[model samples]
Target chain A: MKILVVEDEKQIADFVKKGLTEQGFLVELCDHGDEAMERILDQPYDAIVLDIMLPGRDGLSILKQFRKKGHTTPVILLTARSELDERIEGLNTGADDYLTKPFYVEELTARLHAVLRRSSDEQMSLLQAGDVSVNVLTREVKRRGESVRLTAREFSLLEYLMRSPGRVYTRTQILEHVWGYDFDPNTNLVDVHIQRLRKKVSPDKENPVIETIRGVGYRVCKDGAE
Target chain B: MTPRSFRTRVLLVSVAVSGLVLLGFAWWSWQLLEAFSSLSGLDTELVAGHAWLASHLDAVRWFRREFLFLFALGLVCVLGGSWLLAWYAVRPVDLLIDAAEGITAQDLERRIPQRGAGDEFGRLIDVFNDMLERLEVSFNHATRFSADAAHELKTPLTILQGQLDQALQEAPDGSPLQQNLGRLLEEVQRLKVIIRRLLLLSLADAGRIRVALTPMRLDELLGQVIEDVEILAPELRVIQELEEDAWVDADEALLQQAIQNLVNNAIKYNIDGGKIRFQLFRHEENLRFAIANTSEGIPEEDRRQVFRRFYRADPAHSRKVDGVGLGLSLAREIVRAHQGKLWLADAPEGWVMFVMELPEGAGDGAVESGE
Candidate 1:
């Protein structure tokens, strides 16, 4: 995937560019706002990482202008301020997603992939991890082709993990996505639910589909039951 | 002597001055009455010219009676007029006292209303409002500085965390270097958390808190919190008695942060393998949530100081615990923003309990008038 990163700070821009480059994406970096706008108008890229507080132009205006011109490329916003108005405004101005600063690049990568996948034509109706499958529309969970009954909360947890198998999610991320919490409670809430989920789905503690990365968090296997 | 109110002081001064004027008038009038009596004799000699002027004596006696009546009326007038003067002097002072007492640190923008006094009182109000203006400016400056510093700090933190995370991924699995990198990454994450929290606090300090309120079941949220606590501290005995349909319109994330901070404190200060109990119920128009745990006792003096920013009851043991001493303060701020009250409750001996009282269905509003 080709991506463009526009940030004024040299170190941050370089770090992000290098990270995205190492992740096998063609990343074009721009430091100045006018120059970034010039490049954005010149060509097409899969995604753009635009910083809100840029020198030449603020991210919101750029987004507004870009959207006004009718460009449909998926763009993710990076902002230093966690102000709600800015987040809502950015979303209203055609941003696919928003990430607050002080975030890990892996998180950015994950969000980028998620945004790209969402913008693609193929919409995911069913998500699967080996024998366990969750139909997003019907809200059904099946283990080994057998329909498994689960609580609404448990179903949401399973669906979130199954959507991005093999991608480890931190507890904070899980809390934010699954629990719809904007702030981290620093509790082992994800662990408790995942345990109950493991019992009902895999039932085998030794070869569970949900894997725990110690000192990290939880993830589902990309392919399981080997 | 008991301290008098400003109104009382002004009234006393006015009464004293008026009383002294009334006494001086009475003394001068008594002397004038005596002089008028002497004038009756002179009038009889100059005008009547008759050796027999007994009627002049009777007229003088009548004048003495009328003079006494007039003096009595003057005394009554002086009393009433003095009371009115006292009231006039005290009214503005009473208003100034009420307005001054109502002012809080959060509302430096508030000014005493002008009543066209054009006196010392008005100047006092103007001076007071000017001082408030300066205070607001300085306060805004301080808040903006911290917010700016926190904002600037994020880029560096993001780079550090991003690079460290990347290096950790490149290192071999289970290698010592990777483990070290993981530790470094955690520290970076901690820094990120501190900065985020600091920014939030700065917003709250500036009374610019933004919150999106939604109606949700408090019982359900508490159940989830307790479930997490059970996972983390399995050794501790936990009990929860939550009422059904205990709902509140609040910002979920903010309320959760407040509750989690309280629970974390309960666990942190608790004795090893101690018991914790949580209660949720509706009282009147408020929903009450009480969480208690068996803990090392707090001194009587320290109990009041617990909610103070960066207050640690036992400084020596603070290091043994992992916290930045902002948990309770932040929790309290969040609760206050929700128009709720959170306080350290008077618990049974050997227990530390916190009581959170929130109105059952408060509408969405800024945190402590912030934002």
Candidate 2:
């Protein structure tokens, strides 16, 4: 997928570009706001990663102008402050997601993948394999038509893994996704939580779903092997 | 001695002065009457005025009685009049006291309303409001300071973090270079957390914290917290007593963050195999939650400092207690921003306890909030 990155800080922008490029996405970089707007309008990319503060024109103003004109390409806003209204305002202005600054590129990549999948997929809120069905919008999980309850954290962990099934995620990636940016990476929090999820979902049996990849991380079985 | 009221002090001083003046005038009148009565020709010349004395021919005795009667009546009038005047003079000050009591640091806009009569009290109101304006300016500066510092600091941090993350990925798996980068990145992550929390605190300090209120279930939140506690501290026994259907209005994320902080701290500081008790119930018009955990309790001197930022009860500032820094302080700030209160409370020896109270709320929209 092609991605457009608009950031004024050249060094940070390079880092983002390199990260995305390493992740195997073509990245087009623009440092100036006016040029960024022109480039975005010039041609469409699969997704856009935007910075709030920019030269020539600010990110919000650009978002406003293009969104008013009905640009449908998914956009993720990158900002420095997790201030009170900035996140709400960005989402309301048609941005799909918001990430605070000093963020891991992997975190950004995850968000990019999420927004892209949301745009492309038919059922963005539902993950279904075998007898287990997960509903994101309603937050309902059913195993073989019997309702299964999960705590908030469990639900989040499940949703993150189920978003892209059959894909292995490392411990650090799981920590960033499930806990947050500030969670202690050294702790066995992810392992402990995953264990809880396993016990709750499949008691008295070796769980076919939520397969743990030894020395790597965990993944949801696409085939839901018994 | 008991502290005296300003009204009483004002009344006493004025009454004393008026009483002295009135008594002095009565004394002088009596002395003049004595001088006149002792005059040889006065009894015959002023007989009509001294008729009461004419009956007895002992005019001084009759003058003394009548003058003493007049003195008592005059004293009563002066005393009463002084009291009324004193009350009137201090009425404005009473209003001032009432207004001043309501002006807290969180609300500087609540100024003493101008009386508009350009009197002493009106000028006082103007000056007080002016001072509040100055205070409000300083408060706004404090709020802006955190956000500005975060903005300036994050750019370089982002660059550094991105480079480090990139280098770590490039480094071979489990190599020493990778280990070194991992450690550096963790420190950077820690700095980011500190900065974010500091900003949140500053916003709360200025009473600029923005909360989107929604009806939510504290029991559900507590249930989640319990699950986390179980996973994080399985060796520790948790005795939970939660009131059914007890709900509270909160910003779900912020409130959850606060409660999680409390739970995490309880686990982090507790001795292995310690017991934790969690309780939630409605009290009066508030929903109260209390947590008691077995731990090496805080010293009396340090108990009050638990909610202070970066204040570790350990004197050495020792190897940091794991988790996000300033757990108690941030939790308190979050609770305060919700118009709730969090406090360290007295507990049994060898245990620490905290209580959080929030205004009682209904959970009518809880299910619909899932959208």
Candidate 3:
């Protein structure tokens, strides 16, 4: 997969590029907005990570111009302005995903994959990590070829973690993605839900499919375990 | 008293004093004229002969008619002149009221037109303009400070968070170093939350929160909030008395945040096994929302101050609750920004009830979405 990261801040651009490259994806970095626009029009990339604040043209206008010319590449907006109205504006301007600044690279990668999968025509509805397989369309989960009963929220949470296995998500990220942006930030809801999900999915907690990153968040095991 | 009331009193007193002075002068002139005629002995001269007496009677009748006409004219002139003077004196005050009424939060820089120097109204305008200047300066400072602080703090925090994430990734699984890094990351996350909330409040204080108003089903929003609340506090029993199709014109995201904050507070402050009753209904021209929870109600003295910034009922901060004390303040601000009123209502059964009343149909003709 080819990805273009357009950010004015050199540190962030370099960090994002290094992280994505280490993940085995071909990543290119562009620090200027105009250069990014020219490069985007000149090449075909699978996904684009655009920042809102740039030297010349802003991220919103660039996205607007890209969409006007009928580019369908998945774009994720990176912004420091966490205002709700600004996020809506970004989405309305043909952004496939929105990530506020001070975000985890893993979260960004997860959102990237999610947006790409949504845009691709050959997207599969079934997500499999280990013996647990989730069918997104039907909201069904199966473990070891047997059905598992999960609530609506549990299904959503499992689906989010399964999208990118072996990547850690923070509690805040999980809450924002699964529970929504309005969920209280101070609650232990994530831990409670995770415990419930584990009990339902793995009756014997000795060999759990989901692994906790200590103070971070939960992630699905990369190795498929039975 | 307000400058407006003071000016009104001055006008009234001036009119009364001028009217009394005019009446006194008229009475004195009438007495003087009668005394002068009596001292000139015209009455005795006329009574000396019959012909003289007859002429004197006719002359007396003519003088009486003229004097009555002149007195009536003088009274009309005095009243009219005083009324005009009072109106002239109060004209500046009326202008000031008009100007003040037109000033809104968004237009705080607007000033009243000043009169000439060395006059009362002129001095008033000067003082008002001086106050406005100070306000504008302080408001700008606060707005700028928050924006700059947010920008500065977020950049370093982002860098720190990124560096920590990178280090955690490289560390072997189950390592002691990884555990310490995780703890550090949690602290950073907590700081991030504080900074985010602070920025939110500052923006709200600056009146810079942009709301995208849309017509949405209030019941549906409430249902979603309840679902979220259940996940957060599963022990609390939530009863919903939502009216069907209670549509409201509001900024969906902002209103959702406000309602979520209230529910979160209820769950956070409630005792174990307490119940939360969520009710929604329309009252006249307002859409009313009442969220009542079975908790120890706030003290009567502290009820008014609960919406103040960083005002916790538990001043000692002994409650193990995890909040920076910005929720209620932010909620009230959001409500006020929406032209709504949010207050703590007296609950009959010792429950803490928060009632929000928002004017209906405010979002008419508003753009449904942002571009």
Which candidate should be chosen as best, given TM-score against the real structure? 1
- Give the TM-score of each candidate: 0.80, 0.74, 0.79
Q: Grade the docking of candidate 2.
A: acceptable
DockQ of 3: 0.32
Q: What is the full ranking by TM-score, best candidate first?
A: 1, 3, 2
Model 3, position B58: C-alpha lDDT score:
54
Q: How far is candidate 2 from the true structure (C-alpha RMSD, Å)?
A: 6.6
Weakest lDDT window of 10 consecutive positions for candidate 3 chain A: A176-185
Q: Residues B1-371, candidate 3, lDDT per residue (tens digit)?
A: 87667666766776688778878877887786566456445665545555654556656546545876877787788767766777778888888888989876577899998767679889998998898889988888877788778767876787788888788777766577776776687777767766777777787776777666678878878887787778777889999998877777778767877887788778877878999999999899888999999987788898888888777878565233335677788888888877899999989766999998887663435446434
lDDT by residue for model 1 over B130-227, one digit each (tens)?
Answer: 88789888987888898789888988887887777667666655567766776786567567767777787887887766666677789888998787
lDDT of 2 by residue, B260-348 (tens): 77886787778878999999988999999999999988878888788887776664432345344576888898898788999998898
Q: Point out the higher-scoring one by DockQ: 1 or 3.
A: 1
The candidate with the higher DockQ, 2 or 3, is 2
When only chain A is evaluated, what TM-score does every model earn? Answer: 0.78, 0.66, 0.85
Docking class of 1: acceptable
lDDT of 2 by residue, A1-226 (tens): 9999999899998989987886678999999999999999989899999999999998988988888888989999999865556777787788899898888786787689779888998455667755677888799988878889997888899888776555555666676567642445245778888888877666546545787755556778768522
